[model samples]
Target: MSALRVNNLAISLDGFATGDGQSLEAPFGHAGERLHEWYVSTRFFHAQDGLPGGTLGVDNAFAEQHEQGFGAEIMGAGKFGPPNWQDDPDWKGWWGPNPPFHTPVFVVTHRPRPSIEMDGGTTYHFVDAAPSEVLEQARQAADGADVRLGGGPTVVREFLTAGLVDYMHVAQVPILLGRGVRLWDGLESLEDAFDIEVVSSPSGVTHLTFVAKPR
Candidate 1:
């Protein structure tokens, strides 16, 4: 079976994955790209934009890991778009024609929409299902490759509570989002099930890897 994983999920020092007031204008809300500034300067990010001269170090190496051995993705409705995006029939996604994800993406939402196929082999399938059901669908789409849990904190917490995640890599940024959607909510002593390893990067972000222990 392919693994299910989360990579580069940046949370603030206070454990907020995203700040409040999310909209088309501010996807990450008041957080304002602060969480991803570490990867934005990496060669991996620059390569995505067809650019050059990005720093190649710890952050870049970690950023590059996101592209390896993943065939499908599962994300929450919130991660798909801002609140009430379902109302807009024309809103494809935050990404343009050629999105970063080059696989079938299963979006969990209450109001499901018809699948939207985009350029670069990315297709969005909106459905209402539990984590295990969605994981099964994504696993089938993966076809032997791993499935990535592209999240917005709430989604990650759901999967964590269900114990569906095989591995996770969370980048802890040095900021305090006093009020927002938190990642660690309802998950107490989560470290008990997963063996964690921490690595600090020069960019001032610490990467924490959680590998599920044998049951």
Candidate 2:
């Protein structure tokens, strides 16, 4: 069976995945780009834009894994766009016409919109469903490939709570966001279920990989 995987998810030392007051201008909210600085400097990120000259190290190595071994992706509505993006019928997503994911992408939202196909192989399918339901949709579209669980913290928490994730990679950034959406809340003792391996990058980011223990 294909695994449900999460990769390159950045969070602060305070455990906030995203800050408060999310807007079209501030996608990561008050947290700004602090969470993703490590990834932005990676060669994998630069390569995505057809650019060159980015850090070639441990951070890049982990960042590069985000696009591999996945045929479908499931993301929360917040990750798809800013607040109330559902209000705008014309809103496609934070990414322009050619979004990054070159696979079927499922957007989990209370307000489902018609599916949107873009320049790349990426196609956004809006669905209003539970975590399991959305996972099923993504798995079906995945065609035996693994499904990537792209998150906005809340959705990640939902799937985590449901015990659906098979693998996850979190980049722990060193910062303190006093108030924001946290990733570890209500997930006490989650480490017991997975075999976690931790690595500290020279870039001051900690890479944590979790693989579910066989039941």
Candidate 3:
């Protein structure tokens, strides 16, 4: 079976994945671009923007993996847009006409909408379903390739709780936002289910990998 993986998920030392006050103006909320500073500094990010001149180092290595071996993606509605995005019929997503996914992307939301096909081969399909059911949908869409578990903290937490994730790569940034949406809430003692590996980078962001152990 194809694996369900999460790549380049950034979180703060305080365990917050995203900050408060999420809106169109503040996509990452009050957290802003702080959580993703490690990623945006990479050569991988520069290449994605069709630019040049970015650091090609340890951070770049992990950042590049985000686009590899994934045929489909499942993201939460929060990741798809700001709060109450369903209310805005005109809202497409944070990404413009050409999204980076380049695959069938499923948006798990309470309100399902008509699918939107973008310029790059990325198509957004909104579905009102549970994590397991959505994973199955993404798996089928992925065919023989792996499925990418794209996320907001809430969605990732649900999948982690459901044991639906096979592998996860989290970039632990050093900053701390005392108030925000945390990633580790209600997920106590989760290390037992997955073998964890921690690698620190010169950029002060520690890379943590979690791979599910065999049953």
Candidate 3, 27-132: lDDT as tens digits: 8899999999889989999987888978788899999999899999999999999899899999999999999899999999999999999998999999999899
Judge candidate 3 against the unseen true structure and give its global Cα lDDT, from 0 to 1: 0.93
Q: Look at candidate 2 and tell me the lDDT of residue 12.
A: 95
Q: Which stretches of candidate 2 lie over 4 Å from their true place?
A: none
Segments of candidate 1 deviating more than 4 angstroms: none
Q: What does candidate 2's lDDT look like per residue over 73-108, in tens digits?
A: 999988999899999999999888988899999999
lDDT tens digits by residue: candidate 1, 36-76? 99989999999988999798988888898898999999999
User: Which ranges of candidate 3 are over 4 A from the true structure?
Assistant: none
Supply the TM-score for candidate 3. 0.98
The estimated TM-scores of all candidates read: 0.98, 0.97, 0.98
Q: Where does the lowest 10-residue lDDT sum fall in candidate 2?
A: 40-49
Worst 10 residues of 3 by lDDT: 48-57
What is the C-alpha local distance difference test score of each model?
0.93, 0.94, 0.93
Instruction: List pairs with backbone clashes in candidate 2.
Output: none
Full-model lDDT, candidate 2: 0.94
Model 3: how far is 60 from its true place, Å?
A: 0.9
